[model samples]
Target: MIEAHALIKRYGDRRAVDELSFIVKPGQVTGFLGPNGAGKSTTMRMIVGLDRPTAGTVTVAGRPYREHTAPLCQVGALLEATAVHRGRTARNHLLALAQTHGISSRRVDEVLGLVGLADVARRRAGGFSLGMGQRLGIAAALLGDPAVVILDEPVNGLDPDGVRWLRDLLKGLATEGRTVLVSSHLMSEMAVTAEHLVIIGRGRLLADTTVSDLIDRVGVGSVLVRSPNGADLRDLLVRHGAEVTGVEPGLFQAAGLDAATIGDLALAGGLAVHELTPRRASLEDAYLELTREAVEYR
Candidate 1:
């Protein structure tokens, strides 16, 4: 598991991270979410020991990342997919990392194949496309088979198929009991991939909650109603404090009330109800609501 206790990072007068604290448990995927300039990259850098925190502590598997004898084996990260040397082949790059950790050529080959880069193992990283670069970076991260995995914007350049493949790969890692933390802007993908979320804004912790709970907290979904007497039903619902909007001759949307209550009201009002369905708020809807005030880029 990964833990952060009152983490803080500052640059001159501006604080990049401030008193942030959270835990990323194993056996599940935790999503790091924030708007631009929300200090997500800064936090990830601190977690991997790339940036020094001004105060507080962050540890992976019970210790700081730098304290580990073999840090790569303790935590695998892909903070920047394009950080690789432009001149080196994908295989050789991973081979160099593997060599440092006493990992074998066989394991390098295994990770290369695992990331679907086996065919282009000899190709130089400079020639690889954005998607291919991401794959190669992922291959390097898995080379050590670490217990904790952290990735920043992993799906930045991936296509639909690659995105799905990455989703499965991360899920598989969590299935193996690895602590997985990934940061991404794609809410639709994060909705299905991450079980828990750590949301921050302006360098401070905003929420730490599960996907379902987050949705439920801000999810006041509207109700769709179909009735033969739409006008009469709308009037009755308005009387009961429902903000009703007409969709057509026989269909309408109702808010400030639920389906069951609307159904009961319609029944009492002698309205023929044809359908009463509640549209649950989606992850995107909830995220926008929670982060509305936190968005830095507008």
Candidate 2:
């Protein structure tokens, strides 16, 4: 688990992170979301002790990252996949990190295979493609089998297949009761992979809720109803206090009423209903609505 209390970070006069606090628990994937310049990178850096917090504290598995005897075994992070040395092979890069913590060569090979980098293990990292480089970074992250995993844009250079593989890998890690906190702008993927979310805007905590709860809070969902008697249905729905809009000659959308309620109302009005489907807001929709005021980069 990872915990942050009133965390603050400042660069000269500007505050990058301001009084942020959130708890990321084990056994589930938590998504860290925000618009550009929302202090997400700064916050992630602070979590792993890449940057010191001006105030407050952040701990991984009950203590600050520096206090752990085997820091890599407690938390593994991929803040910058391109930070590796260009002269080293993918296997050499991981082997170097493994040696720092006394991790075995056998385990290094295991992670290489786990990340599908065994084929390119002997290849120099500088010559690797963007996707291959990302795979190597992930290999280093899982090298210690840490209890907590932190990744920032892990799918940045991945193809569709790699994206799918990463989604499965993150879910699998969380299933093992590891505390997984991933930052990504891909709302659709997060909606499927993450059970909970910690949203920040301008370095402040905006929301810490589940994916379903966040969508329900926006409450922008509507029910689409199709019928031959569209006009009549629209009038009836409006009279029943539902905000109705015509989509076409035979279809309408209704808000402030659920599908079941609309179906019952249409049935009571003796109207023939061809279709009634609920259209809840997507994760992207909710994210935009919530961070509308918090966006700094427009």
Candidate 3:
């Protein structure tokens, strides 16, 4: 599990992360979402002890990452796929990381195969493609078999199949009772992969919620009611405090009311209802509405 309390990070005149607090639980995948330069990468760096928090505390498994005896065994992070030695082979990269923590060479080969980098394991990382580089970075992360996994844009350069593989891989890690925190700009992928979300903007915590709860809280959904008695239905619905608008001659859009309530009101007024379809808001819609003001770059 990852716990951060009022975490703050400053760089001279700029406060990149400001008083951000959120808990990432184990046994589930948590998405870390934000706009460009929303301090997501900064926060993730602090979680792994690569950067220090200017104020507040963030701990991995009840202790700061640097304080752990074997940090690699406690947390596996893939912050930058390209932050490797250019001349080193993919296999050497993992081997180098494993050597730091005294991990067996067999484990090194295992992770290489696990990430599907075994075929080109001997190739220099400098010549690898973007997708291949990402795979190598992931292999290094899993080398220690940490209890917590933190990945920043793991699917940055992956193809569709690679993206699907990453989704399943993260889910499998969480199912094993490990804390999985992932950051991505792809909202659609996140909607399917993450059970919970921690969204931030302008270095502040905007939302920490489950996917279902976030959708419900946004509540911008509208119910489309089609009827022969469209005029009468609209009148009755407006009387009940519903905002109604005629999309066309026979179709009406009702806001601030659910489908069941609208249908009930139509029935009581003796209106012939044809269709009562609810147009629910998507995650992208909710995210934009929630973080509209917090967006720094527009």
Ten consecutive residues with minimal summed lDDT in candidate 1? Answer: 214-223
Best of the candidates, TM-score: 1
TM-score per model over all chains = 0.89, 0.87, 0.85
Give all candidates' CA lDDT scores. 0.93, 0.93, 0.92
If both were scored by TM-score, which would come out higher, candidate 2 or candidate 3?
A: 2
**lDDT tens per residue, model 1, 39-98:** 999999999999999999999999989999998898999999999999999999999999
Q: Mind giving the per-residue lDDT tens digits that candidate 2 earns over 13-92?
A: 99999999999999999999999999999999999889999999999988999899998998999998898999999999
- What lDDT does model 1 reach? 0.93
Backbone clash numbers for all candidates listed: 0, 0, 0
Off by over 4 Å in 1: 227-256, 260-273
